[model samples]
Target: MSEFKRAITAEDITRLQVYSDPQFTPDGDAYTYVSTAINDKNEYESHLFYKKLNGSDATPWTFGNVKNSNAQFSPDGKKVVFQSTRSGLPQLWVLNTDGGEAKQLTFFKNGAVSPAWSKDGKYIIFNASLDHDDDVESQKEQSKEERQKQNEEKKKQPLVINRLKYKSDAKGFHDNKRNQLILFDVENEKFTQLTSADTDHGYQDISPDGNFVLFTANLNDDADYELINDLFTLNLKTKDITKLTDGKGGYHSASFSPSGDKIACLGHEFAYKGATLSELYVFDIATGERTCLSEKWDMQLGDLMIGDTRLGQSTTGPVWSKEEDRLFFIATDFGATGLYQVTLNSDLEVLYKDDNHVFGFSYDPHSDSFILGISTPTNPCNFYQLRKTSELVRLTNANAKYLEEVHVEEPETLTITADDDQEIQGWLLRPYGFEEGKKYPFVLEIHGGPHAMYGQTFFHELQLLAAKGYVVLYTNPRGSHGYGQSFVDACRSDYGGGDYTDLMSAVDYVLENYSFIDENRLGVTGGSYGGFMTNWIISHTNRFKAAVTQRSISNWLSFYGVSDIGFFFTKWEHGLNLLDDPAKLWDFSPLKYAENVETPLLILHGEQDFRCPVEQGEQLFITLKHMRKQVEFVRFPGSNHELSRSGKPEMRIERLNHICRWFEEYL
Candidate 1:
């Protein structure tokens, strides 16, 4: 094995590190971020960590073996306000900036999130699901009444509900109706409602002077709920609300400048090649001159957090520096994320250049250093402080202890030409302890969304496969983002045709170039669209010995009415309009070719998934079993489509173990 000792296990899923909501303290000398520390019991306790920009170590500010996160510093920098589920429901807690016993601020039942400090730090502003109720008993009563009504009406179709909140992935469909602004008094420990309205007013950002709150809402009770997300300013003292931007498209992510005279935000008002992209807009609240920064300053404005974001735009994440003169935000050209800086005067600059991931950034003006969070394909996430030098010094080594025993493999990117002569990008992680000439079995890994790009970052499951002596290959196919708009749009009408060719070409490239990879013993797997494609591949050719599809859409016709988002995404993605007849949806369904399948298949799904829904997997498994194909189905309880990403800890570990067990059993 290339003269090095061949290790039995190159890597194991021992540790996972992540940093959330990194921000600078008011003085700009220290930084704080929400860190989820995991332990052997397979439980997680999120805590806040603070380190001086130039200080040697980050100090933990929470204790008592509880869940804590989302820390925001007070204006004076003496104390930090954070959120914790330690109380069972997410509530606000305040602690000294230097570290002290935390005191609970809000005793809420419905749950509170997105805590924002007023400029004066005397008041805390946040959105709470005050009146939105989904009580089990209430739901039962409503459901029973609805069923009776439906029976009486004798509707065209039977009325049924798969779940209380169906179609939930990483984030559930939040029923925060009339999600109003709640004000908490720090001194008196009393709570007050700042804005009490029937309409939902979300995304609250306090002005620099703490006099106003900037937010977006459908104040007019508009019919097209998807239309404009107009900006509004609420006078916290007088309780007066004023509308700001009148432009079309969603206008959100508003933040006030240090001077309090101006505000910068992301605005979706332009269309590129029939697709919408956002522009950064800085509204001069005093003069009422709303400037479109993308048009005037060449700033990149991409749509972010869209329902189908991985397949669309990710133009979000904007926050102003302490000086308020420069605005920092994330920009995506093709599929990779880059951090950019835009001067309020209309000049844009690239701050950091790296493909894929950029996060955990804290700009402390007092220390003149940036505590940045970064990650690459081979490297697990680590916090770094960047000062005068370009190189970063590491802070927390979360995976050091576990990684000592594992010989983790790093990924390498490559370009493979498809049959259509289109150059498609791909990455391969050679089996850990790889040899020069000895061939090893390989697994073709496909990312979900079919639009999400598998960029530079270490994936636990992907690495686990590599550690088990199987070469792992993943690629960003034609419909994937990160390349550009056109590349992502390429797979729209031609779902199984050109996209299939790209995957086959990637495999061909692997067989031709990698002498250590076995083309004879090959396998394929993916989730979501990747899962759908897996079904497609095995039906066309029995090249893979085994295949596993997770939360997949095996049959489109069954997917049309069952999934919560199926109706909207169906028409948007494959042009399967609900109003018109669409035979094309069924034509692309993988179950259509189930008769030709020969490779053994394993189907994994979350029991609670309403996105692709659990039935899609069941349909595929039933049809395959009926055909007498070697098939098995594994279902995760209380899990959803995003179980592979943000599910419960025990369930997540079980998922990893099962995936390893399946691949180990087959390859």
Candidate 2:
């Protein structure tokens, strides 16, 4: 009998399972992770899976259709506290590892998240949003439906804007609610409000002794206009707060040393604005002294690799070692994210570096092993156990059955030399069922976040393109992370100058080197920054036969006023505000060059996208249509800028089908 396999389709995204947020028990005897998948109802269902470290099969610990994530094991290893949307909104839920019914611990009106256990496991610290004038008792009295009705009434009223930052892509328009910390006493079943500031508070870590809680916030009067995250510690006993940072730099991902005498954090002082590489720092608790530990390291810290399949947060830490002499963290360098260890004395070494994406991880100091959530070009993500001397031990095979039924392609790495002798890193995936001497259409995929990197990770859209008999090429331009600070910062202020040439040079190199790619049937597509680049590429050159731009920026002048971050991002990326040089902004806009575009283009935008704003696509579509060019517009209702990554499940599938349909029509 012959084996059977089918090419991955756009609908496979629904069947794919995404694994993230791996956590290890205190004694390292067991681990738990979140597995998310789209159900038949076209809604995401995330459940917790538990597996023993003794080579046992994993089993689901939490069931049902709710989204459960951010699982943190208690210090005693008996209880697991996580955030779940079981109660209509996200709230903290506690579960027993030994098997028992889970209990809801928080009933906050606006929901609670990022739960951290105290050392003794007697309490859990979390953040919840509440209006400054609203009381917890009153909020608890209102039911979900009542709150919805109240919100509807409020929406009907006029929105009064006073702050420069009043809207966000994630949470939409701002309300009076502010994020505050809450302390939950497990035994007493009591909820105590901690911080009451009007600004939002980010809970970082709780001291080992349970006497202090480390958090980040900007309590300054000018916080609305400034972009800074200052670290502070709140004394649990006296309710006193002490500022650690000098308020000049942004700081986060802090952890207390094992002895509680020192603090480790990752932050930068805005030396190069938003492009500055985050450095590791150590703060003395007694004297309030700060020291930069990673000032000499050129790599950017944290998991900077971008992928659409990821659905949960991971530890991007300065995690303290058991002995307090060393700290382990993830850093982006050379097109990959790797685990690195840095000692208090400034000694640094790489613990794990490979051609895979380490999206999430949990370290067990007692066993000297790590539970890593790893993803490759062919795999979505799976949990693995790695020790100092041993190889990766697979803990879960969540995608094994799916992989057996699908034909996934692995990309071949390519290094292209730009016109200025600068090297650009990229990868090319041959179409499925590809044969020698046969030419196929090609699609060039660009990633968003000119500050983000597209590395060795599984991308569903890219695979679907390849499955449709099109060679796919993706590159990390000069502005992308994982390449040192200088390389990543090079695209700033000169967006269309060097970055444009680098991408074109990559196309030229691939065409010259690869014989299978059809030069005439070329397509281009991207979202966000990649969308901007796609628009720019089509207008500047008609080499591409088709182009798709999603949630893109066509005019910097309008983008400056409409986007949530447009006010400051314009000044940060372009090196000038709209008032400084309107002509320069227009010169950089792709709408200005709409008349030169000859490629058939498709504009996809989310109606509620505050990041790029739908007007961007509207302007470009209207301009191109006015010129009688081949252009189409797609507007996703109730979707935001994250439509491609974490949008509505059915809508995500629809968006994928539209991309495939457009390419099939033109390419």
Candidate 3:
């Protein structure tokens, strides 16, 4: 056995560095990525890092702890353009690889994001939200005193709500500003507005010949009532926009082939209600022939895997191979993500498979290698290199030193039989300092996104529980990704039935196989969807001694109107809207069965959480209190739905402390 170190603590999470968004230069000789670390103010700051393909040491390309991302190299590989917040607002900046400082490129009022380079390297396209009648340079010169006066006046005025989608958890309250595509000429430094529509347009890719730009937008009059985004191609010469995908489903991540003959995209037609998996599709530009390449693959063709408070977005890309006849993308399977390649003939082959989450990756056709950002159960994410010959190389060790000083447990994978005779996948994590024949209190950790999977990723909350001398177990039940569409769709409408049995079966299997787990001292906890399951578990049985639910949904009936996405999410998940069948909504609500609860429960919620509003937690607390059951509620002020993963550092630490305290008091 290795030398024993200290158990992992919540404070350790702050010291670790997160790596994401690896992109190789056009020439494939070097690559750049984003490395984020929490500053002294407890805010995340990302910097750009660069490395050469010859296995050279990595170094910071852009200094300062400011936010820098979306680094893309020009065709000649001499200049690199990226988005940065150094000037207070995020804007485009360019830096020369050989030498020189990064120069600011855009001065738009709302700033810019998702920058894409033209093939000729003379133009850079970006997305920015702007008011319909604002002049770019004129708005930039607005007096600071005048702006403050307007802000003060607006604060004193009443807030008049009119839009259907008024509030969002991530971006906050809605402004009338809409995101639109804009083109910038690198030589003249001119910003041109390409398309102006009431709806938003996101930049995707530039055609190979540099004559067309690909994007996605929803121009429907009632777009707020539906969830649909169609693909489109705009000609730069004539300024003509061509619709690619039919308005039947949602689509994103559209990429053009090298020959400009085909386009690869990732989306679904909402086939199996809200639980349908995203499938990859190929579009023939000439014939308008659309083909679903991954219709029968069963696995979700995008990154739905979640973990620690990593800063950058977790997005999947369908990059075209050098031959232009094949596409490379990532898919979730079981508890990990696998990179696969599909030929035009529909021959799918797994190129890289592992029991870890591949958060982001970039391919270099020149070297036939991939720069991968990966995370394991014991390690936070870092960069690695995978060659065509199947050779693996570790490129970055951002968390190696910290890991050496801590005791991290690698979970053991297990397969248990569900009540329906189906197989359930789970992992059992022993305490940091494990001893044979020593029984310990067990904790079953459930994941949210009954649609999302519990993967072999580094989950801090579960690790903290294990560090505190508890045997932690988590699983991907029938209603999770990576196991196929049918399994994920199975948990819908029957919230607490088969899914609950699958979890119990996992606990039973672990107790029967691992003699060190004390069956009598079992506890359970989860957040979001997991929170809902936690509530359902307590109501359905008294086997668990204690439980903690975070940002949970107690009543589907109320969730329909309260949650930001609840109106449609309720209909999509339950297959029935609130008005269509209120009784059905109540049938799955945990609040309806709170009277039967016997276990001591702890409810943790974020006050500003609109996804599963704190009201959900309040309703459950009130119900349990009315029933005279043992329950405690902890509300985090000024926090949102993503409080656990990306909330303020102090709040997250307090949350962990609350859970540990609750468990210690009861368990």
lDDT by residue (tens digit), candidate 1, 344-462: 67688777656545544656666556666655565555667766455667766755655554566767878889998888988788887677779899999887776556766556777
Query: Across residues 1-667, which tens digit of lDDT does each residue of candidate 3 receive?
Result: 2246788888876888888888888888778888888888787788998888677888787777589998988889899999998876788899998878999887677778888889899999999888998665454623457557777987898778887688888876777899988888889878888889888898889999989999998878888877889999999999999998778898999999989889999988888867988888899998999999886687888777867656786446798889887888888988899788898888999888899988777989988888888889988888778898988898877788888888888999998998779999999999878888898998999988889888888888888999898999999987888898889999887788899999999988988999999888899999999999999999999999999999999999999988888988888788899999999899999999999899999999999998999999999999999889999999999899998888888899899999999888888
Model 2: per-residue Cα lDDT over 337-422, one tens digit each:
87888998899998888998888789898877888888999999988888868577888887899898888998999999999999
Ranking of models by TM-score: 2, 3, 1
Q: Against the true structure, candidate 3 has what lDDT?
A: 0.87
Cα-based TM-score, every candidate: 0.86, 0.98, 0.97
Clashing pairs in 3: none
Kindly indicate the candidate among 1 and 3 with the higher TM-score: 3
- In angstroms, how far off is 200's CA in candidate 1? 4.2
Q: What are the per-model C-alpha RMSD values against the true structure?
A: 6.1, 1.5, 1.7
Candidate 2 regions exceeding 4 Å error are 1-4, 137-142
